[model samples]
Target: MFKIGWLRIANGLIYLYILAPLAVVIISSFHPGEYLIFPPQGFSWRWYEHVLMSGRYTEPFWNSVKIAVVTTCFSLPIGTLAAYALTRYDFRFKNAVQSLFLSPLVIPTLLFGIGLLIMFSALGVKMYFTRLVLAHIVLTIPYVVRTMLASFSQINRSIEEASVVLGASPARTFWLVTLPQVKSALAASAFISLVMSFDELVVALFLTGPGLNTLPIMIYSDIQFNLSPSIAAISSLVIVATLAIGALLIIFMQQRTRKSTDIEDPKP
Candidate 1:
């Protein structure tokens, strides 16, 4: 009983440690003062209003959104197909191929960013947006592949075999039978891709050129030159947005799981 109590206390302390900074940032964002300070001088939404009205972050914010969307769009189908192939088929050097797809997860982000920058520079590629998207695709594919691989592995192969026995083409079986089983995994992969691409800073830092700013870069620049409540406001907005998205995704996944369960085991 004492050990269990101590573990609970430890967990509570850990959560507090993680959340304390977020609370401080959210609180500081409400400060009405020009300079940001902890235990804010007064409470106001001026910073949030300023953030909304100010044109400073608008373009970068949209840029980040655009990049994240594009990255997810490209990453999802490619990763899903790769994952399906890897999980369903036994091929030459199967383990090696899987490891290759998953290598990005093990590689250091800094080194990957640097390598991409160098490769792009040497190739005389100057399209920052395209380069960034491509880099993001590479970085995000591993996550998608990993997620879908697990989902695909868990699926019953007998169902797919039955579809083939019913005269369904491989493509038809994949589309109508196999894909439906892993819809939740697809959503998860897309969400992971979107969030990772949106929040990625190191790769963006290396790839972004003049006139190609992202929200993170803008926030970083503001932090370097001017420390203001607006920074905290923007950060708070990001935090809230991330949390909301996560909550929505969780709800979506839960609904999907419930519906799938109902379909699989309908009651008369």
Candidate 2:
């Protein structure tokens, strides 16, 4: 009983630590004052209206959406392939290869961004939408690979063997058998990749030039020079968008899991 009481206290503290900032930001966004403040002087939707009407905010928000969508599109396939190769097949330097793919997660984002910027400059490569898309993909692929790897580990290999034994080609077996088993992982990875790419600022700060600004970069720039409640409003919108995507992904995975279970355990 003593331990249980201690655990409850610890959990409450953890919850406060995680939620305190979020609560403040949400409250501050509605401040009647032009500047941000906690226990806002009064409630108003002026900041939210300002954020919605400003092209500076809307443009970057759309840029972030495009970057995240493109990044997820490219990262999912490449990450899934890397996950499959690492998990299913025995190859030379298998562990080393997996480590290399996941290394971005450990490396400092600033360092990675600096290195990429230097390389692109040396190549005389212009920073364009396509280049920004590629940069986001690099940051996002590690999350995809990690999530898919977890899914691959949980799946049974016998299903793939059975498909092959029934005269399915290797590619067909993978598409028809292995892919279905790992669909939940793919869904989860895509959502994770979207969230990572959407909120990423460090790499964008180095790699993006004018006209390629992302939402987080815009927010950072605003905070550096001003303390407007509009910034808080933008942040609250981002938080809502992130949570909506996460909830949708969860529903998709849960539905897929139920369908898979029904297929595997059919009854009269």
Candidate 3:
């Protein structure tokens, strides 16, 4: 009982530590003063109103959204296919290939960004949007691949084999049987890819050129030059948005799991 109580206390402290900064930022957003401050001078929504009306971060926000969306679209399918291949097939240098895809997670983002910048410079690649999308796809694919690999490994091979024995083509079995079994994994990969790509900063800093502003870049620039309550407001908005998205994804994955369970073990 003592150990369990201590563990609960420790977990609560850890969660509080993680959430403290977020609480401060959200509270600061309501500051009536022009400048951001802790504990907030007084409660007011002026900053949020300004953020909504000024349109300062609007374009960059949309740019980030578009890049993130495109990154997810390409990364999810490519990563899923790569994961499926790695999981379902045996091939030469398989471990090496998997390592190569997941290398980004271990490598320093700054170093990876620098390497990409150098490579792009040598190739004379100047299209910032295109370059960013490609970079994000490369970075996000490993996440999808890793998540799906675990999910796929957990699925019963007999189920997939049954589909194959029932005269379903390999592609058909994959699309109909194997894929449905891991819908939660797919959703998880998609969420990770979307959020990572959207919140990406280091690579964006190295890869993005002028006239191609992203929300992170904008926030960074503001922090450097313009630190104000509006910045707090925008940051708070992003935090809330991220939390909302994560909640939705969790709900979606739970519903998917429940539905699959009901299908497999229906009550009489």
Query: Number of the top candidate by TM-score?
Result: 1
Reference-based lDDT, residue 27, model 3: 92
Clashes of 1: 0
For each candidate, the alpha-carbon lDDT, in order, equals 0.94, 0.88, 0.94
Sort the candidates on lDDT, descending order.
Answer: 1, 3, 2
Clashing pairs in 1: none
Give the higher-lDDT candidate: 1 or 2.
Answer: 1
Query: Residue-wise lDDT of candidate 2 within 1-268, one digit each (tens)?
Result: 5789889999999999999999899889999886677889988999888889867699899998998998999999999999988888999999899999899999999999899899898998885677778888888889988988888888889889899999999999989999988888888888889888888888888888866788998899989997789999999998887888788888988899889788889883
lDDT of predicted model 3:
0.94
lDDT of 1 by residue, 1-268 (tens): 5789889999999999999999999999999999988899978999999999987888999999999999999999999999999988899998998999999999999999999999999999999999999999999999999999999999889999999999999999999999998988998999999999998999999999988999998899899998899999999999999999889999999999889779888983
The C-alpha local distance difference test score for the whole of candidate 2 amounts to: 0.88
Assess every candidate by TM-score: 0.95, 0.92, 0.93
Better of 1 and 2 by TM-score: 1
TM-score ranking from best candidate downward: 1, 3, 2
Question: Measured by TM-score, how close is model 3 to the native structure?
Answer: 0.93
